[model samples]
Target: MYKKKYSNKFSVAPMLNYTDQYCRYFYRQLTKKTLLYTEMITSQELLYKNPDNYIRYTSNNQNPIAIQLAGNNINELTKCAMIAYSLGFNEINLNAGCPSKKAQLGGFGACLMLNPILLFNIIRAIYNTVPIPISIKIRLGTHNKNNYQHLYNFIKLVSKKNYCKRFIIHARIANLNGLNTKKNRCIPPLNYKYVYKIKKDFPNLKIILNGGIQNLQEAQKHLKIIDGVMLGRAIYKNPLMLCAVDQKIFSVHSIINKKILLDNMQKYIHYHSLKNIPIIYIFRHMLNIFYGKPQSKKLKQYFIHKIKNYTDITILFQKLSKKFNF
Candidate 1:
């Protein structure tokens, strides 16, 4: 059990293909305090496959990271929570907000919102099995039931157990049948007001708002009404923004040095390379590191070209250092 209180002031949302262990390690180079999460791993995968494949991290510095699991089975979830806790994860987050067809077919994700009783049971089971904190990531409502009252009822029922105290609410109604996962993120209007109201009504429960949060300034404004703010594509596409997270959000001064960042990534890539992992796997996450910069396109192109003709990790970084003046 993690004895220290976990801070949810700011976090990187657990994206499907984007927030893997390699990506989390890269993000750590930019910000140390911002909480990170693993990509949503289903309970079955953790049980059937080699668990290390899904939860491996490069170092203990990745501490305070949460593992997001998607499933509806009470026993599987409880077992998975124990596995995550045994592996030293800081928290277990149930995925009740994903609107993907795959998740729907598996009887999990956003569809779990339709069965608040089962969701509550799953949360209760996991909470009982693990001493670490448990959190739920959810959408406001589903389909035609997209309204304030429905959302309130869902939270009211789920919170009745009081097993999960932290809720990460994505301020959008999931249109499971009509919208694809990509469309679900945009087409459904964000109702941050509903999230704020949740905080108002459940004053003791921690409410972390997720959806359409673009920058740290916007996050700060939401933090005034809620406990935390979660960023998804905004941070993944321009991860350099995380460099300011420690200072601006956590009030901890951190030196953002490009040289230090390069050295750390170079060492990380080299370490993975020795383990027979492809460099491209690690480098792909960094393609957007220079986002919004004047040389962003050129740097990205150079990375692609080098990755395609990948040689030694040292050679690749040396070339990048000279060509991009890193």
Candidate 2:
């Protein structure tokens, strides 16, 4: 369903605290083809957190969306995947890439790369229980260079056996040291050669390369070697890049005009305000959309701290439209 639904465009990474329904909806309004992903939800949290606040997704936000789960426990992960499938998600992705110490301490995330058997158990459980397809997002390995062989073995075991249909490689190794997530994203050099080798060895598996891929040119370059590409921080930082994705990567059948985006933002502002989620909570992402453009600073400043009311959001965007006129 995922491949057929969005076989042309690249995908937006599942950024934590950023790629929520609001961001997904806004991006979808800009382009029809780019596949958007949900923020990482830990298996334990999904089982224990109050669903009212933690697990939130609507069909209108992004229909072909994949829900990413962080966990190494087969039973818990499988249960979460089944729940996500029941909730109408088209695909369930295991988060084997996040390198946060907190995630590591929990015995999940990037730490799972060290134990392919454990990872395989989790993948197999999810694949067998849920009728929906399963995918994995992973880093090269944690702590050392030798882990790459095990990572490759893990991928081969899962992909060849059809435990999961796809694997999205982040193209870096987790340091598992004094580094923060931001540093983890950058400090670890991306190993594109290893990724190319993976594609070379596993010709039948669908490989999606991720990390440091910011624009269409870079994405097109990687697509020459991999089956797909996934965009991370860049998509959230500069959403207009998605417009280029439609034209350049997916070759979208039609273009979405700016008025439609603004209209949807207006509708969402009303909906979010009614939920009493302060307008700024939602508008914070829009600042990144206009970044690097004229008057962006002024608009960002206007709304950053003062979206107490819906009118504040309205006036702020109206002011930006008037000044920038994009």
Model 1, span 1-326: residue lDDT tens: 44555589999999988898889988988898888999999999999987665699854667679999999889989999988888889989999999999998999999989999999998888877888889999999999788889999999999876898999999999999868999999999989999999999999899999999999999999998999999999998888889899999999999877777788999998888899888888899988866877878988997898888886777887776665432
Q: Each candidate: what lDDT?
A: 0.89, 0.78
- True-vs-predicted CA distance for residue 231, candidate 2, Å: 1.0
After superposition, which runs of candidate 1 have C-alpha atoms over 4 Å from their true positions?
1-3, 322-326
Q: Residue 274 lDDT in model 2?
A: 82
TM-score of 1: 0.96
lDDT of 2 by residue, 276-304 (tens): 88776667777776667777777667666
Please provide TM-scores, in order, for all candidate models, with all chains considered together: 0.96, 0.92
Residue 326, model 1: Cα distance from true site in angstroms: 9.3
Candidate 1, RMSD to the unseen true structure: 1.6
Instruction: List the candidate 2 regions with Cα displacement exceeding 4 Å.
Output: 1-4, 146-148, 305-316
Instruction: Give the Cα error of residue 5 in candidate 2, in Å.
Output: 2.6
